[model samples]
Structure formats: C-alpha cells, structure tokens
Target: MRIHKRDKARRRMLALLLAGVLAVTGASVLTVAAFAGQRQPPAQPAATRMGTVACGDVGSLLDQVPAAAQPAVDRDLADLDVQVADAYRSLMAPGAGGGEQRVMDALVAKRTTTLRNLKASAGPDAGLPGDLTGLASCGIRRDLVVDASARDYAPDAQAGSSGSSGPSGPAALSKGSGNRGSGLGRGFVDIRTVSPNVAKPARTGSATGTFTSQCGRNENRHLNPDNVIVAPGVSNGAHHMHDYVGNLITDAFSANNRLARAGTTCSNGDQSAYYWPVLRLLNGVTEKDAKAPGGGQDSNVGRILQPADVQITYNSAAGNKVQPMTRFLRIITGDAKALTNGPANAHASWSCTGFENRQLADKYPICPNGSRVVRTLKFPDCWDGKNIDSANHRTHTAFSQANGSCPKNFRAIPQLVERVAYDVPTGVRFAVDSFPEQLHNPVTDHGDFINVMNRNLLDQMVSCINEGRRCG
Candidate 1:
C-alpha cells in the first residue's frame, strides 16, 4: 500500500513475473523470483522502528451472534477500537500519559467495563470468543518489519507539490497534517533487491479455470468510508476512504434493495460490490476529505492515488469444481487490524509491476523506471454453503489449503483475486489508508466484496470455471 527509493540504478527484473495465466489465490500458488541481471540489495532488517497501541481483537472472536444482538455487540466492538486508538494518540501527545504502560493500563481498565457490557449484549448462545475479561488488556507493537531501502522525500518541498519522478525531483511528501506517530516510515523496499521467495505448489488441482470481471477503475470517484459487509449501517465504519468499482450506491446506508437497484460500473451487468482502502501518495496536497472524519481528521492525510489498473479475477479452487456463490455473499480478505492482531489473517501482497514474483507482505515496493506499485489481495475460496455473512465476517468462507483442497465441511468456491496497480511517481512515499493507530502500515491493507450477481450470471460464471474456460 506504500515507499520511495533514492538509487537511480535501472535494473529490470527480466526473470521476474509480469503477467501470465495461473490459478492465483493464496501463498501456496504464488511464486517470487529475482532476475540474475542485477546485484542484490543488502538484507533488510525485519523490525518495526515505531511503536503503536495494541489490543485484543474483539471482532475476530465472534463466530455467530444473534441478529438482534449484533447491533449492540457491533457498537461495543467499534467503541473498543475507538478507545484503543484514542489511547495511542494520548501516548503520542505532548507530555502524554504515565508512559506506554500506564496508558495501556488505563485503556485496559476502560475495556474491562466495555467487555462486560459486550458479553451482556451477546448473551450465552452468541458464540463469541472466550475470556472477554482477559482481552481487555493492551500493549505496544515494536517488532514489525521495516523496509531497509526506505527513502525519505526532500525535506524542503511542500507537502502538496507534484514533483518529478527522478532521484533529485520532489514528489508529494506531506506531514500528515503534522500528525505525529503516523504515516509511512521505513515501510518501502526496492523491488529489484528482493529475491524470489515464492514457489509453485507441488501439484496442481482438478479445477483449472478462471472467470474475470471487467470492472473499470473508479472512474466516477465512488469513494466512501463505510464497510457494508462488516459494519453495516455504521457511518465511517472503515475509518478510512475506500475505492469502489462495481456497485455505484454502496455506502454505509446502502441496503439490499438499494444495492440491487443501483447502477454498476461492470460492463457485463454484474452488480457485485468490490471495494478496498484507497492507496495514498504522501505528496503534500489537500484532498476533498482532508478535514473529514475518514481523511485528515482520522490521520489518513495525503492525495488518494487512483489505481492505474484493477483486475478482479476469480479462479476455481484446486480441490474440485466450485459451486456458484449465492447472491449477497460477503467475503473479506486481509486484516484491517493486522498491526495489532498480527499476520494470521493478513493478506497483504505489495510489489512492483515487473517484480510481481517478489511479493512483500509488510513492505511497499519501490519500482524501477516504467514500473508501478501493486496490491494483490486473494480471497478465501472455500465456502460453508449456509450463511451469507458471519458474526466475525469470516467464518462463512475459508481459504483452501496449500494443496488447493477445501477444508472439512467447506466446499470449493470461486476465489477472488483483486490485483490493483498504481502509478506512484518514483521517489515518492505512499501508504494505504488505515486506522490512525495502525500507523498506515502496508500490512493493514485489505479488501471487501459483496456478491450481488444475478443468479443466471453466477451460474454462467460457475459453468465457465467448471468447463476450464477463461471467460469474463
């Protein structure tokens, strides 16, 4: 989602993968390789230099809560996130709290009371995670990996200047509204320096087909801060701006009927809602939402970079044929709270155009000339086949195993891979918008989708995949 490199050496990774046909889903099938033409950069030191407030992930614990209880539970959970973020800021304020521990202690005390209330909301049969009281405590993250090749912008240039892409040219590097303890820091790596770490799986599966959705980039500027899948009806649910490519009227308030009747950007009349956090260049320019809740006010400052290309492809699971995903199916890929929750659910894949083989989960990529930044988010392909959504927004679907087999009680479904590319000017730092406490780390990058495809169309997609034909 973020970086800049000062070295002007032009080393094209001819051995790296640019584009080819493959069953793109998860780490199992992905491969990273470096071309033998260039000298390798020094090994990167893998650790975060900055620290941020870390707390128990309350939302991830709930598997299934009553619809009636979800409102209160959701509100309480969202409040918990707010409280932790607030404490993080308090820790950063001039002459802040009793240091990090005291601030964490205070946050834990507050969270204890909230956890009690949340338990009350869920009741006995809600199936929430255990040890709510134990989850109240909070801490700090100091072990996140930092990009060794990270380069800072020219200090004298204004935050909003649209400078050149060369070594000495100044790209937009803003102060994030002077918001301390935020923005990108040592989060970018030179793509040419990374060696191949990905390997093709031992064996390919039975299904060998793909269905692509030709949804154009957000040409109409369909942007918002709502997460209809996870926090429906909650304004500013995401706490950051999102770019939409499918459904035109997907917002915090968009109901099922409204979404069905809304216009779409898809050429084939598919009404699926595809959205993800906006990638931002730190060029010091004021955006339309600079002072809004999800913008500068939320510490997501900078000019939002429109993706140069976005390819939404669905590949059949390797295990077996995929059944059609029901309308209204909701799937979320990646952890928006990964900075605090760790990498268990994180799906970040950042790299440059020609260096797609060298995917970096925690670092932004500095591309060579004519190259651009890229974000690859591959969704889980195994469906439980019962619920369209789950309490935690994840249990309804799951990722296929390394051999591309569905797990127990889970059936193969079309796995969605959202590959978005951005033309970030060379030598400029950029970042994915995130919760202020997350420090806009590239690891927090995520994607959201709602399947509103018509039944006939979905059936057609399934047929295309099962037939081993690449169709759109």
Candidate 2:
C-alpha cells in the first residue's frame, strides 16, 4: 500500500511540472505573436533616408557597406562633388548690383540637394556609422546663395552704392613718374620769346646781323630770375608761358594727390568691406558653437575678426584708437615690430587696466573669489577682448590689439590680406606670381583668380588632412 501511494504522488508531481513548462512556453509564444501583429515604426522614407548615415559619416558606412553597395556610395560621392562645384561656380557668377545673394543661393541649393540625395541613399535599414551622422549634422549647407531680390539675402537697399568699380587691374595712373610724362605731362616748362633784332641770326633765316639787346643780354632776367615763386610774382614772359608753366606743376601735384587719396580710400574700403562676409561666416559658426561648444571655434576663429562691439570699444578708447593702423601694418608685414608694447599702447597691458579695474573691483563685489564671470563686454581690450590672452600679458597680444613690433621680414601680400578679411579659411600662402600666369590675363577674367585661389586652398586642406592634421 505504501509503495503504491509514493508512485502515484511522483507521477502527479512530474505531470504538474511538465504542464507548467508548457504553459509558460505558450504564453511567451502568444506575447511574441501580439508584438508581431502590431506595426513597428514605419521605416524611414526612402527619399529622406540617409541610410542611417550622417555627414562626415562616410568612413564607417564605407566599412560595413557590402561591395555591391560600394558603387552606390561612389555615385553619391560623385554627385556631392558635382553639386558642390556647381554651387561654388554659381556663387562666383556676377549678381545684380554685385550682391552676395546669387552665390549664397547656389550654395544653399546645392547643399540641400546633396543632403537629400545622401538621405535617400541611406535607407531605414542602412547601418550608418556614428561619426558620419555627427558630420552630416554639421549644417554645412550648399544653399549659401540667394536671389538678389530676396529681402533677407538682398543687401541693404538703403545703403549707399559701393564706390568700388568692381575688381580691376592696377590703376593706369599708378604706372610710374615716367609714364606721367608721356601719358599725362612732364615737369612745368615755359615758352620764351627772343627779340629778332637782339638775338643772333639763325643760319637759315634772313636776319642780317647778330642782333642783341640789354633785356636779352641779361641771361638771369631772360630765364625768369624768380624761378622759385614764393608768392605771386611777375614773369616778363608770354602770358601763355607763365600760365602753362606755373599751372602745370600745380595741377600735376593736385592730380597726383587726388589719385593717391582715392587709392588709399579704395584700399581701406575694400578691407572694411570684407568684414561683412567674414562676419556672416563667423556668425554661422557661432550658431554651431552654441550647439556644440569648443568644436570648430578654434579653426573658425582664425578666419573671423573680433565682433563689432569689440571693434567699437577699441575705437572709442583714446590709447587704442590708433591700434587698428598698427595692426594693419603688422598683418601686411607679418612683423611684430609694427606692433608696440606699453601701457597706453593698444597691444599693451595698460590698455585693459581701465576695464579690468571696473569689472573686477567696482561691479562685482558679491562674486566669489576665483569665480569666472562670462559677461560680454565691448571693446573688451582694444579690438575684441576674446581674441586677446589676458593670462599671457607678456607675449601674444590679443588678435584685436597689436603685439610686438613688426617682424624684420614683414612682406606684404595684398591678396592674402583680402582673403583674411573675407574669412576664407583656405589658401593664405598661395603663390601670387602664379595667379596672373595661370589665369593667362588677370585684366579680363578676375573670376579665374578666385578659382585658382580656392583650388590651391582646397589642395592644401586635403594634403593636411591626409597627413593626419586637424582640418576643421
């Protein structure tokens, strides 16, 4: 009876355990079926899909992509290259009133198309690499150009027309002093008359004897005794001679002065004009900086000038007002000597003594010791306080202010200056001699100059990147 009871209990327990296992398995299957029945998020649209890749995300995507998909990747890259080139060409094209809209529009449109194509190629299931996505999100759009008629892209309608005659060859008047003689006029010369009766008879003339006169005999008087006219003086010569001789010198000097002034004004204006475009580029990068701190600022900062507030402040300051001239000289010469170092000097520590005193002691009594206040201050230190290194007061004056004197080897490159002013991040050291040679003739096509410059910069950047250098 005991054996029978034990066997029965064992059998019942075994059956219960098997039933429990079966029940759990059934439940899991049902749960999985329910999940399967519900729709998953619809796969990203094929048109918009980036194949799960992002900008600058090309490396990883390139890795995992099968050999079959390599062709597609290559096609996409080719398309991007073409679009970018087109955008650049459009930008270089002349626009209404020579405004920036056309170029900007082309860049933006090309950027959009490239992005769209990239997305389409990257399907919902496309396994894109992480780095590529970050790059894609960089907001580097090709549609930088816009219609000249567009209100936003259009230059200020109220602003006065640019006095510049657009890009042109060297001024005709700038040739040389010798050219002035042939092309314009020589140093003043006077016309004189010799009395036939007093003058020696010409060999071919009918005059009889060697005629002479008391007036003609006085060589000093005949030659206009008062050659150096300190004030209005009488010249006993033909009125035409006096008028032509006297006025010629005065007119030539006056014209030369005018031309010099115009040239200087034009050069200054060109430098300042570039500030606008550079500001735009910096502003865009700043937006990116706001989104991703400490990412591109180092590279981009090299291209941008200090902000307006900083510039204004520097100008307003008594000691620093002259700094811009010095800074300009330094840039041209690449010499530190042109830059100065003194308390009152724009590049010196004393310039900021006033601002520092006001901010640290007067304004913020409650701030804790060693606390960093990040308020924006105009003319913070001559140019823009941000560019200057407050900590390194000894060397390296801020970008806003002058540093040491101009270097001994300071050589000027006008094109490089223009590039810097324009915030072109590439091609600072291109060969200027080659510019004219490669372009055939610079007088007719200025666009070629710009193209060659850009290409040179692009090549440099590529080379740097290939060498494992950081290329913002």
Give me the candidate number with maximum TM-score: 1
lDDT of each: 0.68, 0.20
Q: What residue runs in model 1 are displaced by over 4 Å at the alpha carbon?
A: 1-50, 97-106, 127-131, 142-185, 201-206, 317-319
Candidate 2 off by > 4 Å: 1-63, 95-99, 124-472
lDDT of 2 at 341: 9
**Candidate 2 lDDT by residue in tens digits, 152-197:** 2111111111111113211111111221122111110001111111
Clashing pairs in 1: 32-196, 32-357, 48-144, 159-284, 160-284, 160-285, 172-283
- Please, what is the TM-score per model? 0.79, 0.18
Total clashing residue pairs per candidate? Answer: 7, 42
Model 1, range 1-472, lDDT digits (tens) per residue?
A: 0011111121111001111111122321211111223322222121213345556566765545777887788788877877876776675554453344456556877788898898888776554446654466454443322232331121111111111112221111111122122243445566777776555544365567788889999988999988888777788888889999999999987888898998899998989999999988777777899999788767778898998999999877563688999888889998887655555567757777887777776666677879988898889899888788777787778888877778677888888999999998867678888887777766678999999999988988888788788888
lDDT value for candidate 1?
0.68
